[model samples]
Structure formats: structure tokens, C-alpha cells
Target: MLARASAATTALTDPGDRLAELCARIAGRIVFTTSFGIEDQAISHFIMSRDLGIEIVTLDTGRLFPSTYTVWDETEQKYGRRIRAATPEAAALSALVADIGINGFYHSKDARLACCHVRKVEPLARALGGAAAWITGLRADQSGERAAVALESWDEERALIKFAPLFDWTRAEVAAFCAAEGVPVNSLHAEGFLSIGCQPCTRAVAPGEPERAGRWWWEDQGSAECGLHVGPDGRLVRDQPE
Candidate 1:
């Protein structure tokens, strides 16, 4: 496990200090992005509990769930961390709408990806350009592609350190942490929302479905994305962008 971790990351190897130590060293200039989900809440809970100095930011895509927004505000007030929001670039969005037609993302694969690029990816790049490290709430159990990702990685496109504090945890363990700590989470998870994205792009998964089925359910094979995690240069980073 240690050898695998080292090969997978450029971060420090002290397993005992993997999450907290990294946050302490980097949090001053680092920022954690959240969607107010369980895994995200768990990491935020750790930061709040440890009194780490890091900015907590969220991308207000303007089309998020009411509960997601609610939790964002509530979590800020509860934890006393200022939750900064990055909004969509209006000019880019206008151009996207013009080129793709209104709601064109729903009509075809290209259209959906195009919409995601303008709305999520570009805005996130602007947000992270000045930060030294960006934190996320990813778990290996989330995807087979993510199974080998380490707790911290060198993000090539963003050219910064990327940390996933809960990368080693399982879904149940994450939920248990949230429950144990009494953290605020999105209410939609109880209804089988294994993975949640924009309201228009998300749905509740049924029995035996893949955890990510809630996102981009319409597309067939090779067509899953909402663009925030993809770099402007079109390479996929380890975690969801927003």
C-alpha cells in the first residue's frame, strides 16, 4: 500500500499525517471545493474540527438543487467558514447558448459536453488559477477509474497540488463520519442519489445501479460528464471539478 501510494502521488508518505498534516501545511493558500454532499461534508467537518486555515469555496452553477444551496449557507454559518462562490462567466454562457441553441445540451452528446465546458470547467479554472492546492471530496469507491488515485496528486493541467482527504474511505465510512459528527449534508442522498450533479443532470439511482447513474443518465456508453472536472485542455483530472 505504501509503495502504491508513493507511485500514485508526489505528496508526503507519512500515513499518520496524510490528511491533517497536508491540510495544515497547505490550507493557508489552499481551498476546498464542496457540493454539500456527504463526502464533502466529512472533509469540511475535519477542517472545522481541527480549526484548519483554508478557504472553502463552491461553484454556484445557478442551477443547483435548493437543498444544495441551503446546506452551503447553513454549513458556513454552522462551521463559521466563509463559503465563497464562483459564478458562471456570462459572456461565455451567452455564446454557448447562441451556438448550441437554448437547452441544446439535452439534445445530443456534443451539446451536453459543450454546455458543461462553458458553465463548469472554465469557471473552475479561473477560480483555481491563483491557489496553490485544491481540495476535493473524492472516494475510490466512486469509480473504477478512480480506484488507483492517491490521497494527494500532482494536478498537471491546473499545475497545483490536489488533495483528496477522504480518498481512502468507503462510502459507508464517509456517511458514518458525517453522522457521527452531525455534519450538514444534502438531503437528496437518502433517496438513492449515489452521485449528484446539477438538478437537470441528476436523478435518483435504483437498486443495483452504478453509483454514478444519477449523473448524465441519458447518454449511452462513453458519454458521461458535466465538464467541471475536465481541464480546459480537455484532460480529465482525478476528481469532479466543482
Candidate 2:
């Protein structure tokens, strides 16, 4: 299945075409998780504008910026479709807050990882349950950690295929596409929040800063991930070459 799926996408240059073909070739549910970022908006457009059957969903960490929510609403209105939300489990969230004092993530890296595990990784597990394929907006140029991302890969950990349709796209190209396509994007993007996430965990980048520099800026450089794409050993889950 992995070899066939990889071969099917290897020849496709257009993201929309690749997605359409993936849906046709793969059975069971295909899920796309969006964060309302510029990259995500482009993928959302490719999937929704073409009326693809892929499921669109987001992780509402309950601490997102107001602008993020605004764009989320605007994107749905523009596409005339609802993006399902997978929020943190209530009991788990409450317990985390009680254990860490709400903003304790600011104190240590471990605390932040725990917060992410509860708010993002766990919710993503629920969102991806029974999914045959998972689609993400990961671009290789976003950060050094993601520089090796592939267009299609077999996610052994999740036991499903993972697709990064825009993996090779540059930030400028993505921005241009969103502009030409008139896709609704977060207003914060223009304000230097190139990589937006939760309000407390994110900030605007300075000149010459990396796109993801804004996220988890407090942590040491090159350690800004939230455990969403990495394995238990804290390394990216890369594809095994066929």
C-alpha cells in the first residue's frame, strides 16, 4: 500500500491533483488538519475548492489568538464548509492546569512539552483515529527540523500514510498562491507572526529570523517543536525510503 501510494503521487506536480488522486486510490477516511496559517489555507483551498472528500479538522487548544479564530471563521464562510475541531479532553486539561499552575509552561521545556502532549498530540491522536491517510501543510523551508519532509510517506507510528502536499513550496510561493486564490488567511501574518500558534507560546519574528522563530521563542533555538510531528524520542518521524 505504501509503495503504491508513493508511486501514485511521485508523478503529480499539482497539489490539488495529487490530493484528488490520493482520495481516489486510497480507501477509508482521509483527514486534513488545518491550523488556519497561510500554508494551511492554501491546502484547504486545494481540497475544499475542488470539493474533495478529505475531512478537514483543527486542534483548538483553547488558547489560540483571536486573529486565528477570526480567520478560521472566515475560511469556513468562504468555502461554505465547517472545519471540525478536536479539543483537549476536559478532564485531562483540568488536571494539567492543576499540576502546572496554568502558565507553568513558561518555566521549563518539560512543562511546555507536557502541555503540548495534552493539547495537541493527544487531540491529534483522537482526530486521526481510523484514518487511512493524514494530510498536513508542512513545508520543508519552514525550519531546519522539517527541511527533510517528503511529499508522501508511510507513517509507521500512526500506521497510515502521511502527505505534505506543499512540502517543497517556499513561503513566498505559498503567499502568492493564497493571494491569487483569495484564500482567507490570518491577519496576524502581515504583522510578522509568520508561524502562529497559541497566543502565549507564539510571538512575531524579527528581521532575518526563521519562519518558526516566533513559535516557542522562549526555548533554546532549534528546539521549538510541540511534539505533533516528532516521535517519542523527540526526533522527527521521517519516511522510510522504498
RMSD per model, one decimal: 4.6, 1.2
lDDT of 1 by residue, 20-121 (tens): 566545533677888788888877887776777667777777778898888888788898777788878899888988998877878988888878777777
Query: What's the TM-score of each model vs. the native?
Result: 0.85, 0.97
> What total of clashing residue pairs does each candidate reach?
1, 0
Best by TM-score: 2
Best by lDDT: 2
Segments in model 1 whose C-alpha atoms lie over 4 Å from true places: 1-17, 24-28, 221-223, 230-242
lDDT of 1: 0.72
**Model 1 — TM-score against the truth?**
0.85
Inter-residue clash pairs, candidate 2: none
